[model samples]
Target chain A: MELRQFCSQSRVVIVAGKGGVGKTTVTAALALAATRAGLSALICEVEGKSGLAAAFGSDALEYDELHLDDRLTARTLAPDDAMVDYLESHGMKRFSHRLAKSGALDVVATAVPGMKDILVLGKIKSLEQLPAADLIVVDAPAAGHAITFLLAAQGLLDAIRVGPIRKQATEVVEMLTDATRCQVMLVTLPEETPVNELIETAFAVEDRAGVALGPVVVNGCMAPLRDQPDSITSLMAAGFSLTTSTQAIEAVAFRSSRHAMQEIQIARLAEQLPLPQIHLPQLLTAAIGRAELNKLADAMAHQIELLQ
Target chain B: MTAFANLATTREIIVCCGTGGVGKTTTAAVLAIEAARRGRRAVVVTIDPAKRLADALGLDALSDEPKLIDQQTWNIFDRDPARSGLAQGTLSALMLDTKSTFDKLVHEHAPDEPAADRILDNRFYRNISGALGGTQEYMAMEKLHELHTSGEFDLIVIDTPPSRHALDFLDAPERLMRLLDNRMFRLLMMPTKTYLKLAGAALQALLRTVSRVVGREVVDDAIAFFQAFEGMEQGFRDRAAKVQELIDDPATAFVLVTTPRRDAVDEATYFAQRLESNGLQVAGLIVNRIHPEFGSESPESLRALAHGNAAILNLADFREIAIRERETLETLTARIPSDAVGYVPLLDEDVHNIATLATVATHLF
Candidate 1:
């Protein structure tokens, strides 16, 4: 279950989390890890959160892939853009033009309910179908919508029972259902609401789509309290004589509480799932780049080893 | 003049709205903190069901009513001597529980207990009220209107629910009115009990068939839920219309909040466009977690020094910091209108209390 082993087995790996939990950063890091391992990987982002582009040091990304390194590439899927491309590819250029002229593209796109989700999923499926790539890492929409997108094929299949749509929907469902082909990772912070939602989302996914539940990545985990209890007691005993010293002790105590909460939640989740759990330490700084990503990759790689 | 400074002069209410997890809570907190620091008594009310305001303000707990952060009490300003510069104007926060707010709205609108009970006791009312995205949004507006009418604060900042249905809250009043006004629905349910009596046998038969198919009592529960809401459409709709009018008013300003990330910005942009199309005034945009620029040394030099071959390094250790900062700034400048955009730098710690919120306020204002 090393990082390479997982990527080698799964064609489509979805990274999902609550917003601001650094799904995009983790997606980029995992993609970079895959590339570093000598696998050709395309990091696809659906949220239009050019986080992948930023992580790869690119100003912008188009529907077409931008090479970040020899084996790693990144692209963003804009639903409207993907729809137009999809229409053109299917030789429905006239219909596409007519829809554009009618100014009904937006209406049609949204009115169909799960249409955007379908297009986004369709695009990810297309990337997964690419011949050269060993893996396609999707930085999906936030947890809720991502789940909706993952289940869109089934939803459409149930809602529309006949025709080419049913056939396409069936294909999408098959792709998602096969664990060896597709896997979903729930990314979460070590907190009450996120952890609660993560567990709920896992159950929901299991019930609805029967998609394989991959490991959960708890992002922004704080380091364990390094200073001894005696030292802390001594500092407290020393009184609030110095503001800096007092603040230091309080900060450590606060950090410990946050970290402990995260660990407890992670353990609870691990007890429920058969999958490995990876803990990514909170960085001292807010901005994460290649350096922080590599450290996360190393941590993930270690988790993968444990899984094996 | 700052973008927000201009907004402050014109807008009455600033609604910071977005999907969940996009920093909508933090954005609202920072905006209120900034306004208060600028000598205005600003109140931030969050309608997100999951309470994060206390966490964002670094407080252990928050109440349904506005709570002043004790930390801000230490600062004093001489220029606004009428108000203690140190205490200045106060920044207050509260969390709006949507379901409770909706119930309160029902109680306010109904003429008597019997009438209110009739509506509340309806099964349809309970199920749809909680499940409908529009209901949550509308309740949020109702809460906003309550705060606006109070006149206790100069500015009221609201953190809207995280959903596209957030607009439904603004649009709820109209939808509710439409539903109430529907002659067809009323006509069908006119002999409510008689209709229930006649349909009960058929519904039972259908439920039995459904139970056989699904191996569950889902249909029976659903039927019971609908039967309960039979005669209360008008009361609910009338209140909904009133709430809708409050949201559509020109006095309210919608502030779209997003992170510097592309997906968030795009969603915010889409929301702003939708608000504008619906004739809702967009006060501005608050882009959070912007990468702060480091001095002098370029990304290229750092990249060259670190080299592509390096295995483990933090972003701060190499030129990726400069690169990311530049790219983020460029994206912000290109996508967000300069006049309506406010940037909050990335902080080392999560913004969970008054001091950090004040720090965020300084950056934003």
Candidate 2:
């Protein structure tokens, strides 16, 4: 598959996964990858604290959009701002003020089920309506709440049958379930627990949210020790006596073992999920920045070429 | 004794927390197993719905109730033939079922069966009670309170959800209380008829605006749900107070877990500093899955020796990761006491079963 074709399959790509799985990193890298493929991308951060801006070596993002590059832009979206936007756009600017003044918005957002989530989803819906960018990537909440976050639209539609909230939720649901409009990309580590959770989340999103699943982004895969024997004996036979340090031997063994385990998990994921996998190498750094992100985006672009 | 060993045996409540995918759940289970090995009855409550804990315990499934590990399962710790039956204490584990816990709370607080049903059957309540933000954290605390008061175990270790929001496990009660005590909530609690008749001019205007924007039905549902809880507010308030008290008790200990990743370390540090501001001490810091120092050889020398051999060069790569991780841990250990820190090097495989968990315990204890 061509990177541009894959990028254009869905206008909105929601990247979700367990915490610490590098969902934010994948979101930023995917946006960069799309932009590299000659498409303008807008990345939306819903949780506000995902460190998306930091991935670009910038400060914290606000509700206002920040253009990172010529073709890439990023912004943070909070529910309160979305609520005010939803009302003002609905010709209730005066009502938005009164509710904000009385502090009922907090009550409604907190006390009512799905109000906070719907407000945000409804805003995203309007963005799609405006065709904000050629591609919009949402750095969604972690896996635990992601199902509920995506299902908030359906939940509201069921709970409130006759209201502007219902009408907004209806449109959000349409945008979410339509494959051409939106698809969810779940990220996970090449480990047992994360892989287990990713498979479960993928199923739940498909069954409940009725959303399409894209290629699974497997992050943090150990670089393979290609064309080299894992055993010290083989290396000695090959005339490389290297130092006699036990730590060196242990390091080789440890890396080989973890790589083997990761391979097993990746195989298990494919057997179960039946989805194409994009493997990202584990960077030997404490945090990801622009350079590391570019490396990941390059890896993603390379994988997309071989995806079929 | 190691700081973790002391806490496992002495602390009545141990809260295991960390950023996502940092092995917090496994740490909690290991701590509970350690407590049980030390002859204390322990139960671990996991907020993550994944069945990893169940798989570790060799169980098909885990419910809301604590299920005891059979003696046969505990026998995995009896590795030495010289000493049999090493696990003298008992261990039980359960996954927190947030919805049922919330439903039980509603039933406990409501004045009668009909009143409870009135709230439970509400469309708004049915949807939000289980899946709302902050509800899982609140209910985890609620279950901790229930288990603590029952006196069934000497120690309770809980695995909180993975995120920076895990801090909410501590603040959910206060946040909920503030929400319930908000003037807006009180106004919403007014019966529809009474609210229309008695609402002040500003409130009336607010209500009209709310109806026009969100639709009258949602407002009706909100008013009806709050009205159903009119007499039950005191009960809920009192329970929240007790939960807060339990959180403040000296017997409760928070254990911070993290990986060598910089973000995870930063989150753990932030969580610890916040707890410090509240005068709560983190009993231990567990750094899971750290890469050990591979060798003393310089990468340049190794690359020269290998003549660009891929396998040997890969060893150099591994060495770099090990050093990078060591540096990350150095920064983390500086913030915590040397005695309070436990480091577990990267294991060969996932800690999926009791055998693997026992292997981790050797490093932790």
Q: lDDT: which candidate is best?
A: 2
On DockQ, the leading prediction is 2
Clashes of 1: 24
The DockQ score of candidate 2 comes to 0.56
lDDT for each residue of candidate 1 in A77-141, tens digit (9 for 90 to 100): 88778777766765556455655444334433322345556767777777777653788888887
- Candidate 1 yields a Cα-based lDDT of 0.64
User: Model 1, range B1-365, lDDT digits (tens) per residue?
Assistant: 47775565456678887755667887787667656766678888877655667666656666666777653442422233442353356778887766677677677766777767766765445534554436666667777777777788888888876755566665667654544443323333445576556656644343343233222333333334333344455666655566567667676677777765555665666677687678776667777766544333444543444233121112223234345545654665565454676777655555554566556666655
- For model 2, how does the per-residue alpha-carbon lDDT over B252-363 read when each residue is reduced to its tens digit? 9989999988788878888888788877888889999887666666666777777766667766776767777777888888886535788897787888888888778878
Worst 10 residues of 2 chain A by lDDT: A241-250
Candidate 2 chain B least-lDDT 10 residues: B77-86
Q: Which stretches of candidate 1 lie over 4 Å from their true place?
A: A1-16, A22-186, A189-215, A219-303, A306-308, B5-10, B19-22, B37-41, B58-60, B65-88, B163-168, B175-187, B192-238, B295-335
Colliding residue pairs in candidate 2: none
Q: Where does candidate 2 stray beyond 4 Å?
A: A95-103, A229-250, B79-84, B188-198, B300-306
